[model samples]
Target: MSGTSVLALRLAGPLQSWGASSRFTRRTTESAPTKSGVIGLLAAAAGIERGDDARLAPLAALRFGVRIDQPGTRIRDFHTAHHAVTGASMPLSERFYLADAVFLAAVEGDHTLLTGLRDALRAPVYAPYLGRRSCPPAGRVDLGLHEGARLHDVLQSMPWQASAWYRRGNRSPQALTVLREAGPGESVQTADVQRDQPVSFNAAHRRHALRTVVTLPVIPGLAAAGGSRDMHDPYAALDAFDAVEALEDERP
Candidate 1:
């Protein structure tokens, strides 16, 4: 309750990876974007270099929530490299990613800070990637800065950012799912604790703490479908041909 502003970001990309528990030989991605990754992106936009713990602290403190408009398919790639020390072949590694994913992320904090972040995203100091350097954002990243908004409110209010194809296929156009980082004193029935709280970004002393997150079901008040009409029956012609053939067979 320090301030009433939330910075919204559109995290849509061709390929994105938000690693939660990556090991030496395996880099896995979470099904949805992680707070660690999104905070890192904000830090980058604000021109905070890696390992700058002092500057990252405030950004990491902001409340985070994500709306999974499109939880794109998971994809993996195999990689092999030589060890730097021994010059020997290293163990094959598998890197995971989400393809054609779209997410609406919100960071609720002080009005001044959130406004600054929105401006920084519009004209970033360093190019911000989705989660890794190689996976760049496909569309505009800055959604806008909303004053008098809270974490849950922003997540629920933001319009759905699903892909055109995905939206067209939806049976109900007036629904979207939101997953939020549980805050203090919130009545959470079920929540998953994730170790994504950033302590220090120092490579040698990097650390994280556990954070509680809960999933909220679809919120109402979505805009009506637009000009893009849903596709007609996919098997209409085939079904008609099959009926004609059945009728001819019965005539014999």
Candidate 2:
């Protein structure tokens, strides 16, 4: 595509569930939002019906990436239901969700499509949810459009969307983690592979493909450290105290 633009989305919610390998009895969630979940959100914004393959194809082809600003804790719930036809009780089912998480998602595509998507999200035809209908977005879903930006650039430039408490706990104000979809034949240094790409959303013949996602560390508004130090090291606190004392001693 020529002159691509990225439509940025802030997917912060109380309960977000992006299921990857869910079965009948247990519904699990991926640590990060899946490609299928994101595309489905776009489709909803565009008013595409469930089985509308023609309208869904373009959205599915977009390059998707997600930055996990805050990797929320996983919470599970036990639920039981009764059969509709009979009075038989169904087995207990375990549902998983990420509580109080914030993700920055980028969908890079043509400028026209990106602008259209931004507008649609602002006043979506169908109400958008954080994966499941029960889990709705907690904040403004659209973060506006980034013109002529690639996936990596968008991830790096987007501001941190973590909660105030989470940001306060961070060692550095600029700390952030990015998870981008790897390009073709690109060597992935550290990544987790997931099979969540949607080939067909048809219930009768659902299909997906494998996608490689690389995790990257981004430090905005700060220079890179000379060397890495463990934030959780007990000695680090002592070292900081020593440094403060040395500075105090040097002061006039």
Candidate 3:
């Protein structure tokens, strides 16, 4: 009932696409990672294969939270044929634009598993990435754990305000200001974060797969029995889930 959990820090980045059904068209869109895909990534890092996923049942108990940053904007280049036939110069059009976004993922689960994952991250059996191969974490994982706290409470407690960045000593740390929906025709205040400078897209393309890195969060109840994962079919694995009870007064 009492044990430590592993904290896997994923630094998501801009230009990363986690599309579910993008293969049909060359066009891609942004979406959350699928359970199968994420687990597959983990398995690959561990030098495992598809069949090994079920063996990682212990990881199922982890709690996962994705904090999106860098809400990226998409850019597209087109090719056109002039003759409207094969191999002819044609007109090109902007297919679509996708917003660049970053995700900070905290995986809270078994302490031993977390430790193993942390170690694996440092020296991954295979090169690992947040959402794409090009992006890298801005900094090393700032990981920790907490007990007796709900997931929502932990999220709110994190220093989300822009001022906290300087106060927390991340002077040069990249930050973003998020805008939320209040109501129609209503406005919310967001800290106007100035763009630091023009990023060298060429250099980013050459050195990395993505433009920026992602920030992660505190994962609670990672090491408890079962696992702490955001598995889509969590109800199917209830026995292994953390024993945290949903309170009547708790708001979703």
- Among all candidates shown, the one with the greatest TM-score: 1
Against the true structure, candidate 1 reaches a TM-score of: 0.83
Give a tens-digit lDDT track for model 3, residues 114-191.
666666655667765544454433334334454334333444344331122122343323433222112224343532
| lDDT of every predicted structure (CA atoms) | 0.80, 0.80, 0.39
Give candidate 2 regions above 4 Å deviation.
171-174, 184-191, 221-252
In candidate 3, clashing pairs total: 29
**Candidate 2, residues 1-252: lDDT per residue as tens digits?**
557888888787789999977989999999889999999888898898887788888888888988887799999999899999997999999999999887888988888988888899988999999898989887678888888888788777666666655555774455577777876577877788888887777778777888777887775433322122112233557878999999999999
Clashing pairs in 1: none
For candidate 1, the lDDT comes to 0.80
Per-candidate TM-scores read 0.83, 0.81, 0.46
Q: Count the backbone clashes (under 3 Å) in each candidate.
A: 0, 0, 29
